[model samples]
Target: MAEERSKVAAIGTFASAADHAECRRLHRRYGTTYYFATQRFPAAIRRRVHALYGFVRVPDEWVDNPAHTNKDAQSRALSDYRAQLLRGLEGVRPEEPALRAFCDVVHEVRMPLEEPLLFLDAMQMDLTVDRYETYRDLRGYMRGSASAVGLMMCAALEAGDDPEMLAAAQALGEAMQLTNFLRDVAEDAARGRIYLPQEDLRSFGVTEDEIFSGVISDRFCNLMKFEIARARALYALADIGIPMLPPCAQKAVQLARVLYSRI
Candidate 1:
């Protein structure tokens, strides 16, 4: 009994160390802005944040990678990732260190499984959908891809279940996602993806051809400005929830919001 217990303890320690290291590596490589913001968090919270980032980064890469030109292949890969994530969430440690670490954090924080599941649903959409017909349509995607992430963060921060706070977090997530879409217009175009709402494009008289051709016409500029204004509005809403977080977590969240808005 003693020897078996010792073996189990050793495995736990090794897994914990490996998991943290993997999360750190993923965060450093893929999320410079977010990783920088995490530095302000208390040590325990920082590590958990890293784990969450790492968990999300894996499927994001699979979906976004230029080499995965085959939509069916991307779909299959995302499905596999979802399966592994679900297993991890259920307390079955996945082979991947990042997944394992994320599982540990989820279990530790008692995060709802539905949050990550919703994120996977968004990734699945990426496989089949390219353009959003309207802002409302885009919001549906964001609910899974972005808002779910915010809720997950709230769970990690132990911010309690306040309806207003969750709504603010959702707004913040949408704002950040919109900021990224604006900044990555060229990059996303190269990937044959357009995150901008089709309705907005039509309203601004910016054609898909203009976007694909990298034309920064006056119309395109106006469109971008409009989107930025919307994102800023969301950021304002998000700002209200910052003070609602525990004092120790408030600074990190504030820094992240400011930095993302700047981008």
Candidate 2:
């Protein structure tokens, strides 16, 4: 029966039906725009992508809105998660299904462990660093958070070895991240975080008070326009790598790029 075949397919190499299902759920709930683009991918690739999203989202959540009020407790919990991820990468089966599935994808794609570690480092930084003095400073953080994730995705797509592809992927990731910072400015400000670089704020004559107070001044509008244009430039740079991807996978990536850029 079709149902039986589907059930059999659900038992992943490193995870179970429920595990992959959980990953899918997280991706759909939190990354709705991305989820739409992912649906265009082949089923196998979609599953792997979902697992990757879930793996990163867990740590991001811990740092962003932790259940524990104590900073030390939050740090310890993040460290524990990182340790488990390392163990999984070392061929030890993780007890958590998200880790299990993500590790399986890493092995299947021959992805390096360095990318995930870098991502964990970024999460740790979020605990202590809330504001960036310059775009370069923010970029340093994004190297571990956004660019590393793009590199991981490149590996997953079997295009990691190409330098050009990696460059473009990195640009794409940063562009998306910048978009997120711009969109979440108020929300992040409320949480005592400000992702926009201080230099840009100064250059545009926008102050933290205006941002925190939700004051949409002409200066703020100009600042946002400037940042939006910058994001679009990065998207343009990323476009160069699309043709390098396999024909079967190109459309999905393109769709994601288009949708995210629109946002």
Candidate 3:
């Protein structure tokens, strides 16, 4: 029984040991890259990170999987999941292991409830908005999906309300998310989602068909180059904030930044 508890120390009893165990399993199975970086964290922080990842990942899988039941079913699943999280945040124990574990961390760190809500809103957006017409449009989506998660992490790490740190964390989150979009362009395209901005494609003389057809035209290469450069710039911005984290946390976040930037 004790072996099934969280690997992180200082995890009291807000969530049952089984809840954290399930959260940890979700993180390890689906969040391979983030899970790699998480190992560098102090145990206390690592488990909370797992809980957070599990929380976001569950709703994401509900909507993202190509074989998902249907749009309405996915939407209903997300809504129901959000309701459970809301109850959990209000101090009622949730039946879902992921929500219960994440709520435990939220209460422990005094994280603002708004961040998770924003994340859920972004997930909701995924149901209806599959293609972004412009970089600005994509940024609007990312503000909730990526930036909010960064802000939540900043709170968890106790960055002490520093605007610079907050900005850097958001930049890092955006950078990582952009990297994922780049790496998964083919997969997301297969799912009928196009995260790359339409304007960028037009500017580079690439077309939706070219992306869908998986062509490696010079224009497509140029467009990818431009986006990769933009992602790197965000990573550079994130570097400025790493030093602001608690001493024990700096290494882990820096490693994550470095790993994602390499992609």
Candidate 4:
């Protein structure tokens, strides 16, 4: 009995170690900026952050993969991924390495099950929605894709349920996501998706055709400038939340915020 128990414990230890390594690899490969910023965190918190990135990256890849030509296939794949995540969250070990690691973090932090579910919903939106009519409409999407991520990070840092901190975290998430949209305007247009609000395009006298053509006209430049200003404002708002985090977590969050804004 003792030998059998030892063997079982060894297997569990190996699995946990392997899952954490896989999470780190994924974060390093696809999330260079965020991964680097995580260096500021203590070892335990860094591992959880890596797992979080791995979890988010998997679903994001499902929607954004260039080779995924069929929307139906992508939808089905996303559904399967969501199912696997749900199972993992329910205490079943997920087969996928990233999901396994993420499940461990979820259990550790007691992360809300709804947060990952909401993120999956946003990825599903990418498959069906191609444009936003207004900033308000875009924010609805960000609530899932970005805001949930911030909330998850807060849980990982053990930042507690401070309402003001949560609000600022949401703002930080929006700021980073908006910066990404601006930087990837041409790339996203190539994929037949435009994250920029249609109303803003109209106001700036910019057209979808111009964006598709990669035209850097004064109008397009002006529109980008306006977006940059808006993102900066969010960064300012999010800055207030950093101080609310534990001393160890604050530096990492601040570094990520600064690095994303530089993008």
The digit string of per-residue lDDT tens for model 4 on 1-263 reads 23211111111211378888888998999989999999999999999899899889987887887887799999998888877776665556677888888777777767767777778889999999999999999999999999989988998898999999999999999999999899999888888999999999999999999999999999999999999999999999999999999999999999999888998
Residue-level lDDT for 17 in candidate 1: 87
- After superposition, the stretches of candidate 1 with alpha carbons farther than 4 Å from their true spots are 1-15
Which residue window of length 10 is worst by lDDT in model 3? 1-10
Question: What TM-score does structure 4 among the candidates reach?
Answer: 0.93
User: Which tens-of-lDDT digit does each residue in 166-204 have in candidate 1?
Assistant: 999999999999998999998898988899999999999
Among the numbered candidates, top lDDT falls to 4
lDDT of 3 by residue, 1-263 (tens): 23211122233346888888888899899988788999998898988888898889899989888889598998998889878876665556677888888888877887777778889989999999989999999999999899999988887677778999999999999999999999999998898889999999999999888888899999999999999999999999999999999998899899888877887
Candidate 2 versus the native: TM-score?
Answer: 0.93
lDDT of 2 by residue, 16-97 (tens): 8889999999899989988999998889888889999989988887887735457787789788887777666655677777
For model 3 the local lDDT of residue 159 reads 73
Model 2 lDDT at residue 199: 97
Query: Which segments of model 3 are wrong by more than 4 Å?
Result: 1-13
The Cα error of candidate 4 at residue 100, in Å, is: 0.8
Global Cα lDDT for candidate 4: 0.86
